[model samples]
Target: MTPEFAYFLKVNVAFVLLYAFYRLFFYRDTFFKLRRTTLLAFFGVALLYPLMNIQDWIREQEPMVEVIQMYSAILPETTITPDNVPETDWHGLLLSGVSYLYWGGVLALLLRFLVQLSSILLLARKSKVMQIYDTRVHVLDRPAGPFSFFRLIFLHPGSHSDKEIDEILTHEGTHVSQWHSIDVIICELICIVCWVNPFVWLLKREVRHNLEYLADDTVLESGYDSRSYQYHLLGLSHTNKSATSLSNSFNMLHLKNRISMMNKKRSHGIGRAKYLIFIPIVGGLLIFSNIDAVARITDELVESSFAEALMPEAIQLPIQLFPAVNKEEPAEMHRGYVLSKEELAAIKRAEEQVFTVVEKMPEYPGGQKALLKYLASSVKYPESAMRNGVEGRVSCSFIVRKNGSITDAEVIRGVDPALNAEALRIINAMPEWSPGEQRGKAVNVKYTVPVSFRLANKHKASVSGTPAKGIDTSGRIFTVVERMPEFPGGQYSLLRYLSQKIKYPVIAQENGIQGRVSCSFVIGADGALSDVKVIRGVDPSLDAEAVRVIKSMPKWKPGVQNNMAVAVKYTVPVTFRLQ
Candidate 1:
């Protein structure tokens, strides 16, 4: 898996665990009330987010064949070739967006509910009154008696002046009125789900402190003397135990901060300034929690698995970033026919024929230069020619005629069309290759040939100009030249047929046109024209005329590669010149 994806998964698991721990121990009071609600929200977001993004994600992973089919419907038949479509990169952005929207809504709802619950608790506490004695406090315990609604004091009874009582009452009442318990509960639950994240723990602590601070500030607003209130708070420092969700009369640990805050004079309007800090902190948390970032991590992991599956045995089982490419037969290979020697030979012969034809053609400008140079030059190459440059061996099968000529050729283990067509064309144009003789007699033999299109030094040339100008010409130019194959009948007959079929200007310029019109065509196993595409147009009229004429031609003897009739790619240049 990709590192990003691994990180995402790890973070998610950690968050959930840490959150669970916090909910169980740290914030059990709030957890009991909202645990189910939080869990339901998380599950709903998870399932719905994935569903919303799956279709788009699938489209991102679509294979090349499917993309070709999609474009084929929109483009002209001749232009519906594989070269027209490109590999698409899936960034996982859409998935992330959907996930963010889902989770954001969940978080918002949870927060809103917590706020409402706090408001309700505060209202209930405000409606009651408590009588204070020297050592104990009493409330008119209702039928719901000693419940969270009634203030239950756990402090030792003590006498207090009017001012001290006012301070104590104001401070404790603030906690009840603001429903600080609810905030503590909500944060604790968040910590449970995000337990693995240290940040969640920090956030939970901050939430608790904020609740205390908010209550302390409210009490100090009641006009009690700061020094006297501080003494009252110190006197009430004895610890107390209260059940979850119950409003306790005393919290000894919080007394110091409560008294200190009351003693400090308020800076004019500091509350507004302090409140502004929430904007960036809360906004950052929301942004980080978005689903897009999570899914990107997942996609990286899946892509890494795909890459590892393609590794060779020479390397370690888990391949690294730069893995060597070698083909090992998968389980399906055992069911197929193991190719024979004769079959392999025929395929090789066909490929040789196609290569020979391409070599004989006029060299492109800066012929031995880089592919980009050849491609960028005024002279255009055909898509079929580009197929011929595909690196690797292709095995095909074909039949030999009584006159020792190759007939039907079919590609069994197919190569890319650009290279495959070149192999087929050469086989078709063979000058009576010796037919296979079985049992010491001339007999029809099935054969296969594996043609490898390796780049040799002789093919390289400078793209910009001569190598003297700092242009590198050390690589062969793999050009896709467009050309019309020499059909059985003369050019004149082909021209006449084209004029009758297509409604376009049909003219054959002189035999030696100043520039060449390179066109690419596919030669099927039956020697019929299948797809004829023009990669780069010469004169618009010339290109149209050339395409029309090339498409309107008779079939030739099929090419034989490996004793099988196979489709071949052929590139020929139609030079229009003043004779």
Candidate 2:
């Protein structure tokens, strides 16, 4: 699983357990402030817990064993056959589709978040503000209701009585003073990234509700009449139906629950002990996240097991000989049996022969995806092939032996010879696989894989002839072409022409500048070099000399793309030496 997707899962699991605990033990308790803090803390932990690495802790608890030595004599031989399992294209497509959908959800939610924030800012500007002491009271002339965004409070001044206004201010003031908007924004952000998890939405709702409960309690604690505040909340409920998601609103849903919670008796401090459940819950998540690595280590140790003593020595016993019999007489059978050296050797050879079929196929470390990733990263395009734009797929097959070592790799289908060699080099560098199994014994298996070599995405040069914007076209320059752009003669002659016709710069020779300077240019449809410039420079003198030589040289042919001469860009490196 990707770390990003894993993180989302971990957070949701943490939220489910943490939220469930809250509902069960502390949801109805009168510790409104504590509840708010605890909810925010839960979110903070969920976000950070996934990034922590605890593999070391897990490894420390694993049983350690001395290095095992495999004895060929003790192991029974097994047969293995390569299964032609085609790589699943749909699995890749599904994963890519899911990734796109996830990002789409994130983008949509982010856009919504920004729009909500914009609306809140717009509201602040439209409403008139009156400074009362240290607070800025934004009076919405219309019936937008009361809410707090950061330190600014928005309220419809004309819609509320003086007593109601006083209570609203105290409630929203607590939201601002306690920085409750931070919690709302935090939850909204988390919900945006983890919207796939229903528990995230539930957690956000719980947080917003807890914040409202805290604000309501703050008003009552500041000497407001409980019945009066409750009645005022009911009176405004109809008008205050909607509010910005990333702000603290004076009114929210669940007024009935809020009233009930207020009337309920306060629980003792001992109820906080319920939070202790997090200790084990978090510990379990850490173990789960790091378990895959530990399991891989354990599999390695188990797969390497070998019997301590050789099988021949363990089974060998003193043989008793029977009396010699005449040729005509039948030989008496011995009680104990022993094999001749030749027979024993033959049995050992049979046990060790590479099998053609196996019960379980060999697997690359981290599966096929990881193997592909390694190949993509490790393979380098041959310089000769790159200059000529040689591109195609290379299919190679190799043996994964019983000991998990890769061997006997050969390219079955190849493009250019240079490309084939590069492909083989990468396969040879692959790490060992989990060897194939047959009847619970490890065996050799053959595996085939395909690797493709292609040019990097090309960028358009300033020159014209680009396809019109509306028309679909292959805008990429040709790396390989029917007739490659050439110097006076052929590819081999181009190297000779550069060596004999070119002059090393005097300043470069004096300064001991000795490196290759890479230059790129477009061969126009008319077989003329345009946009000639040094792409990589060793020194100023060397770079100018490389460009000058290429400009002075004659071009005989132009690359053909789509059966027509096109402006194909090319890059070549020129070397400079003191000699």
Candidate 3:
């Protein structure tokens, strides 16, 4: 899933679980103030918790991979056409239709929301504004809200006697004084974004209901007889038909429950303890939302508990993978010529397992800065690959053994055989690295490095004449590191933020120019971004805009090498496509 949709799912799932808990425990309680707080909290957490990265506080599971993931656009385009073109997929067409349909629903609901707001405002324009005793209200000529929007109370005063008017204003005064309308606004906004989630709508109902319960309680407490207030509410319930969707209506739905809550005895102080349960509830949501990371941790445990249990402490395999035996011979003959226990144990110790993550990652001879320079100076573009115009990233993986030697080098994913061979050749030739450790014991750790072979093109300099600050002049800036700089919320958040913040330039849009512009920048040891320059540009307008938005990004967590913060050079490809 794309980041936005993933976050949307996380938010909805979290809200559904939280609201379900609210309905079960806190819904029936008489702690009106606390329930109000709890209801509002669900909305806050449902949105914010998914954006949080708690893996560091939990446990880090990311395998340290030596990433060398740039060198694009400089390559000449290599096009190889197949004999026959494939047919178009109707699945894509169907998905496109579904996307349009979902957005149409959103647009329709937003219009409805606007209409409701305007309906209340239209009432204000038509009604007479006056002070009825001490409270300010908009008294409509037509039957409308004994309701409020923000602090503006709308009432059809002509329909009620002096006593009913007094009660209506008194009930609404609690809503205005306590700012209950804010809660209504918050719920409505959530409903719009997640229009399809039924639980969100139900949660909206609960919020409005809780607000009414609060308003009713306040009216009863302020020197009004409970019997008389209940009668006043009952009278208003069946007759008030012009309630606005965006308002806290006095004669709102669920009148029976509101009255029951009023008559219900005050809850015990001990019930407040239930509120503390939210801490764990939110904690679980945080953990589960990043379940991919958690699964890695679980897999590690399972391998130890079950898979390791089944395997012998010593690993002794026959010299040949396929043992030679006759059908008449005993099955034990195929089990192999067994080695002594000490020899088998020694072999097991020699072949200790490789880990994906550890307390500390393996380091290069000097640091990431030296590693990048070494690879850059050493890697030679293959003559065969260049002749065929084959240029793409060759993803290679290898093991850094406990003895700190590079071994088992091979290509995991590759473009051309020549390119693959060169990627592996360079990795195998790498000197010994500082081995990674888990619980103070040196262990084998795997690393993935992708070497790019983009042919240098004619676009030599940046189109935007503005030079980048702190360019890689002194070789202090690094392009590859054990851990690259991360924006606060990781890749998903970074993508979402860029998609929202970067606007297509008016000039570029009008001219119908759209292509990807690769921008490179330095993320300082302090995590501040600097030296943003276009590596390859489509247009000056596009290049400048890409730089502007990137420079506006928040500080990142600096890249680390050898357990120390370092400035790392990074590239982001921004596409300004007009649809």
Candidate 4:
């Protein structure tokens, strides 16, 4: 996944879990003030938790350890076979649709928020203002609000009796003093971003309700009759069904829950201990957020594994920290794994040596995406190879010097001579890179890339001036078919054909180079063999002979897919046995 998508998922998951914990522990408690603080803290933690890198802090390391970089993925031995419709295209299309839908919802909701906010601002200008002490009250001519927004409260003073006005002002004053509008706005903004997540809506509701609890609790504390205030709120609920979206609405639609909390006995201080749950939850999130740390290991282990993959005894860059011969000082000196002082001195080269890996890998003019785009837009298919329908990936390796100059460009693995030279040309022509760093010092680094050449759906019209007939040019080569293509005369006759047509090279025979050659090819819908290339070669002559024989075969029955002829891929092994 891309970093942006992964971050979106992490943040939403955290929000859902935190909201769940709130409902489970503190939802029913009468600790109105503490509940308000806890909900706000939940929002803070949810937004910031995913960004903390815990591994950087808690990772234990050996003292004086050498931090060599080992990248096994640098030179992969895989072919890149581009299809007519790459799977990535479908994935990108799906992702685009989802992105459009998400942003559309956000924009629509944002427009709604702006409209609601504008309506309030417009009323603040038109309504008659009444300054009661430190508060500014906007008296609307219509039956609207009885809601508090920061220091501004909106309500129609003419709609209520003198006594009711006093109770409404007292309730709204608590909302203003406690800055409850800030909580409402916070929840609304979070809900807008994470509207797809159902749990956030519940969390939003909880936040708004808690603010009401605070306002109601304050009115009861300020010498108001509890029974009369409760009746007044219920009456307001029936008359006013709607209010401002971004403000603290005083509608009593949630009167049942609010009244229950008001009548319930006050929660004891012991209830605060439930908040200890934050420790483990936050700790769990930290463990999850730094999940990439689990893949990290000391380079020493990776180097050992890499050596074993090649000839283990043939090459070894041994590094170990051995203490001086002081008392109680042990050193890391394993048998056969340690190097002598003289051998170490001899192996240690100059600082100018090119590194296979470094503290930071060199970056292309742009990042990986731009690098791919540059290669795609700049690369040209060799006309000779294209005419012959030759296609495969060319794996190349090059060094970026300390001064960011490209050098030592060579194709390590090649499909065809023409394609190999073309791949090298592109690498040599690349612009300078950002030099890699090792120990805060600029250093040369080696980079590798596999450039794929494919003729999956290419028409011969561009190359040979004739359209490719009997060709699909619409889909990928089928690996599985209802009817598999076979050699014209079965396996026995096919072996006889190769034995009679093949000529073992005198030089290879003299050199005793005899082994199996693994080759791949595609049998087109017209039963013509194409896209022939060697997967593994025993010798250059043997590889050529194998491909030549395969390409010269007579037409076989083409593979059938969905009752239609389709191109089928096949892999065959040709062994040269010296008898």
- The list of candidate 3 runs beyond 4 A from truth reads 61-88, 293-579
Tens-digit per-residue lDDT, 1-579, candidate 1: 334443445455434543454344333222212333343343333223322322233323324223322232222112111454574424357767755775675577567656655754554555444465332344323211122323333222244456655565565566566565565565555554444456566545545444555555566556656566566656655433233332433343556555555555554443333334433533333333333333332222222222111111000011101001111211100101122223322223444231111102222133222312321221222244333332333455566543466767766555467556655665455445454444354544443334333222222221212112222222221111111123443222343354355332333333222223445677665568767866445567666766776776679534344334455555434433322
lDDT of 3 by residue, 1-579 (tens): 345876888999987899889988898999989999999999999999878865444432323110112222332222223347576767679979988988898999889889988988887788899999788998877875488888799888887889888888888998999999899889988898899899999999999999999888888888788988888777777775555688888888777998889889999999999999999999888876655333333322222211101011111111110011111211110111111111111112254766755667677788554665556656676766555545555666677788899987877656789878877887888999999888998988875554545443321122212112222223466655554576764443565566677777788778867655667899988789998888767789888888998999999877766556778877665555555
Please count the clashing residue pairs in each candidate, in the order shown: 74, 11, 0, 0
- Greater lDDT among 2 and 4 belongs to 4
The sequence of per-residue lDDT tens digits that candidate 4 reaches over residues 1-579 is 445665778888988899889988898888888888888988888788777765434333312111111121121222323455345556569979999999999999888888887887887788898875445788878886488788888888777887788888888888888898899888888888988988888888898889989988988898889998888888887676435767777764678999988899999889888888887998877666654322232222232222211111111111111111111221111111111111111112365566755667687887654664556555676768777866555667778888999987887666799989988997899999999898999987766665545442333345533222344656567754444555653333454566667777777778766655656788888888998988767779888988888888898667666656788877664556554
Error of 1 at 133 (Å): 16
lDDT winner, 1 or 4? 4
Q: TM-score: which candidate is best?
A: 4
Q: Pick the candidate with the highest lDDT.
A: 3
Q: Which stretches of candidate 2 lie over 4 Å from their true place?
A: 62-88, 132-134, 296-579
Per-residue lDDT of candidate 2, residues 459-497 (tens digit): 112222332223113544543444345454333356556
Per-model lDDT: 0.40, 0.64, 0.68, 0.66
CA RMSD, predictions in order? 24.8, 27.0, 24.7, 21.7
Q: Model 4 — which ten-residue stretch has the worst lDDT?
A: 309-318
- Deviating ranges (above 4 Å) for candidate 4: 61-88, 131-135, 292-579
What TM-score would every model get versus the actual structure? 0.32, 0.49, 0.51, 0.52
Worst ten in a row by lDDT for model 1: 314-323
lDDT of 2 at 310: 18
